[model samples]
Target: MGSAALFFFLEPDNALLSDVNGDLVNAFTAVRDHPIAVHNRLKKLPTGSDSYYKTRAVDPDELPPLDAAARFIYLNRFCFNGLYRTNTAGKFNVPYSPSKTGRIPSREKLIEVSQKLQGKRILQADYAKILGSHVRRSDFIYLDPPYAVENRRIFKQYGPHVFGSSDMEELASCLEKIDAKEASFLLSYAYSREALDLFGGWTTHRVYAQRNIAGFVKHRRRACELLVTNIC
Candidate 1:
């Protein structure tokens, strides 16, 4: 999110938007304020490749007009690790992923992001309901819901509350409605034929994404992902 903000600053003129499913809103809000310095420091502090900066770097002044810049949505469940699991009380219960470098919440970035998103509305609701009212033409929607197969463990293994098979079906239905409304939309998911069948009409493009998991290789490992889009 911070990287997107910084990139907007460098090469302005684009409306920034992020769909963070509930859990990470505070972190998202924090980084949107002043992502430059902190993101830079994070890059320098963490030993990584040069491309890191290139990916996150953005212009400061050229950032889109705050009022008209980018926007963010705090949707669905707002808890942690995007667990998509809930407790008996219907609260998200994803535990935080601890980092050795400690929490990196950038206050200024959140403020800046908040300011840029002045007129934007941030609501917490189901994907179907949210898109039902907000989707419109000229809007670009990015959907990164948990993979149906990978996320299925939450039913009994992970916890009581989860997206489950029905939730995935509903998500697909929602995206179809958006497509019907003439809104351009993009979806990211594991590259599986069954997953592709979910969005039957959309063209799927294969893309590589680096998965960053804690206690792992510490280097981003490449994995094949599918980008389902109705644009083409």
Candidate 2:
């Protein structure tokens, strides 16, 4: 089970909904091993096409209705590895792995997800909505934003306004509001002290995450991430 799936399992009482901004949602699609199919289907771009790979926009009008207990969020699609960078126009621009390995598209799992998520709301929107009027007291909020520290200065990582310090502060304020409401919530972030300071009073725990490194051999790096929570 993946993070999105895990969310459903953890909060079974609440309806499941996700706001996938980038191509991470492609994980729910059928797996395709062919080079062309992988390139076109997962990345949403034609091979050799001038248009660089970018995150596809989801229309808000097509979203489902939210039950009172439903939790909402903008999820980065779960591509094979969790690459969550975007382009200037807020498009997903992660490159493909040369391994030629087919991803587990997990149709049955997604269909299960769909069944469990019936009447739940998931749509692409600004973070403000996630922390806005829609979110209230007693809600269980979880935030899993991009965690790479290098995103700050890397030219390749720069996007319109995907994730940054300002976004972090805004999230902090949101969390504070949630806290005021006595809602249960958990946040995942790079284990940076600054991040800890942002979410005052929340206890942090370390979790091992296997992340991908950009290279030909397809290396995996075991790194530490922080999980801050108010639900204990």
Candidate 3:
């Protein structure tokens, strides 16, 4: 989210938006183009368990493109802590939050966001594939891969098992190519020895982020993380 804001501020002409989850990418494209549709759909659906459960059952692929995007937006906005998780059957199973009322992005905001996606490339591919082919000399690449920390793994896992030490190693190898191409890059990761070892080069900086997503109120506090870059 922060990266998107920064990129638009810098006004890059082209970009590749890649994610392993095709559903999310597709829904985002839909919402980007038809934010009003998302807003309208969400408004029509009543808040509470019945509506949330019923909406969750609707298979995104089976629905019209706009409806599918609305489904994705609705769940994220009203689900517990806005965490996207799935069951063994790969269905969204996050419980409806007692909190979180109201609609998602305003119609005008969506229009602006849709305009941004007008010429940008959206793909459902691994990071290596898109970044390998598209990134070139002087291109800026930002990696905010899910952290592999043990205790925090359960909450932070974007997928059932999307990231781990091995995945981090693969990403590190990709950095080599980016370096060879003389491209500038920045990656954010948790403060851990493994993170340091995998991304320890060029320059490193420390920063803190509030742990606002913890399930328990007591656990909500600031945690340390690192910013790694290929520049001084």
Candidate 4:
């Protein structure tokens, strides 16, 4: 559910967007419901190491929905590589990144996003739960689960218990269920042995994407990705 970029691109009249990250989902909801307020709040936040760390230290839960959403967006804009990582205690611990431009989205852009999200169901739930309970015949599902490569330590954006081998097994099971329901689905994941073994039988396509997981432009590299689909 990273960015839900496809959803925004397609702008379907009816769709259900979900993610395991509740804070992200809450931010989306806030943007949808109170774009002007969130935008105003974002305008007041200063962009500097001192202000960034001070805002980061404040618990988002203590703020109202609009303020929390603003803080989330602010942190994303100023944090390292726009990464969302947390410590074992579930506190956001990503260091302030001075290299970032630290520019918030304009009010017009926020309003546009809010308009796109209007009337759509935004949920904070695991993929399995969303697929199990909400999938229907003829529905189109796009799955962009976190990259869980074999024998590699990927950046933990979503926290310690990121996608793992067992989660891949669960994803395979979910694919079967979606097929049985006559729904079309697409999956994007890192091109690796695990991905090939699990999804090679599907209509798989290999693609290369520029990955910035290294958090520096000099270290960015093109990485292979697998696009698996059950569409005819």
- Scored by lDDT, the top model is 4
Lowest-sum lDDT 10-residue window in model 2: 66-75
| Model 1, runs deviating above 4 Å | 1-98, 150-160, 214-220
Overall local distance difference test of candidate 4: 0.87
CA-lDDT, candidates in order? 0.50, 0.49, 0.74, 0.87
Listed in order, each prediction's TM-score against the native is 0.57, 0.62, 0.88, 0.94
lDDT winner between candidates 1 and 4: 4
lDDT of 4 by residue, 6-93 (tens): 9988989998999888789989999999999999999999988999999999999899888999999999988888878888777898
Largest TM-score belongs to which candidate? 4
Q: How many backbone clashes does candidate 1 have?
A: 19
lDDT of 2 by residue, 1-232 (tens): 1246456667566533444343332222212112223323333322221222222233322432221001011122323233445667665555543233223334454345555555555544565575665666678777776553544342234355666665778777777777887777788777776786776467778898765532222334565778888887
How displaced is residue 121 in candidate 2, in Å?
1.4
* lDDT at residue 110 of model 2 (Cα atoms): 38
Query: Which runs in model 4 stand beyond 4 Å of their true positions?
Result: 213-219
